[model samples]
Target: MTTGAPTPAYRTSTSQQPRRSRLRTLLPLGLAAWLVLEIWLLTVVAGAAGGFTVFLLLLAGFLLGAMVIKRAGRRAFKNLNEALQRGTAPGQGGGNGLMMLGGLLLMIPGLASDALGLLLLLPPVQKAVGAYAERRLRQATPGTLGDAFQQARIHRPDGKVVPGEVIRDEQ
Candidate 1:
């Protein structure tokens, strides 16, 4: 007496719906709490040091961060060029980029971000981060496109390699 079509596999009850994680519910609360704490800390510091002094300190931090960004960006580009010339991966010069990011973080008006930025700008921290990133990248992808280009021949039973260049047709 049943139709030819099979029944759907989905659950019929509303209670069967997946429950969301507590972390998701708590994230906004945590962020709001942190923001309140930061505001309170800033207010206390300003009260102790005077508003004018706090303004000057914030201005100095912003200016210092901008200068660091400019200097680090230049140095990173220089290092990238040198690495390329020496037949090394451009990623080896990622420290400069990290420094620039640190500088950017410092430019943001927050004590925690400024502290993190300063840490990232440190030579030892930059080195450690760079090494960790390099290790992860290597583990994720054993060989890159550059390695494929360096290989003389590739053996594939399923498909033949087609060697050709595409000419863009600009309309």
Candidate 2:
């Protein structure tokens, strides 16, 4: 019969769970509100007299913004994938959540929100965000997260005498 507890899968601890949940709930609501506004704008502009031309212009702008955002998203995802393959965690800082919020903002009826969202979706921007997040993590706990990259080991120079970070001799 053993008395010790099992080890955890991941080393780092996340922030409050309920706060994250509340944000998740609000995200969808914001998205929905923006969508409603977009629909209303489209209807109003198209329905008004002498507004057909304006409607078409707005439509064109929307399509262009969508295309730009799509391209940016693709690039961001590719970079994130590459980072993961290199054994480094990518999109470190609130990445998915940030992207989601950005996308939601982009989905709003205004050109400003669309531009902001597309900026957030860009590969360079995403990378910057990830790097900032990594830096913060390192600042918070030096060598702890990186230590997880490989098995804990301690090595000494000028010779070969030191206790490793991990011991697997239990085998």
Candidate 3:
């Protein structure tokens, strides 16, 4: 009892340090594999259907993706106008963002990406992806609204951090 060591409070906890995500390690590798696959598929198609056909296909995909993006943007603007006219917030669940994402993927010049984009353009796929994204966001910030704002907060629009305090009144 006389021979004393530092208490647990004096020791630093490793848990307090931020953990690395698997995605950080695996994403590069995954992208490399995908690139290789895309190249291989393109070569195979070229061998079967000539180089000009691939060029035509890519051009068509680019044009279609552009059209899709333009349409989605217009629709989103129209929805915003309609909401402003009604003096109410715009309703959600239109999948316009997903459509834009699909368009982007389609324009990427890879058949696999085009296929994935087309899949994302589908209503059911958009619903499933949106649900999954929502769940992931909820999980990432488990307690977003309440005590998370107790300390200094970051302003989203300007990316500024300012000190602040939360005031509560008890009855």
Q: Give the clashing pairs for model 2.
A: 152-165, 153-165, 154-165
The whole-model lDDT of each prediction reads: 0.80, 0.65, 0.87
What order do candidates take by TM-score, descending? 3, 1, 2
| Worst ten in a row by lDDT for model 3 | 147-156
The numbered model that scores best in TM-score is 3
Report the lDDT tens digits of candidate 3 across residue range 1-171: 576876675657799877779999899999999999889989999999999999998899899999999999899899989999999988774899999999999899989999999999999999999989889989898775555764326444576665665579888
For model 1 the local lDDT of residue 22 reads: 100
Q: What digit string (tens of lDDT, one per residue) describes model 1 on residues 1-171?
A: 887989889858779877879999899999898778767766887899987877776677688799999998888878888888999877655577788888898887766667778899899999999889889988987798677664524434556654555579999
lDDT of 3: 0.87
Better of 1 and 2 by lDDT: 1
TM-score of each: 0.60, 0.35, 0.72
Please name the candidate that would achieve the greatest lDDT relative to the true structure: 3
Q: 2 or 3, which is superior by lDDT?
A: 3
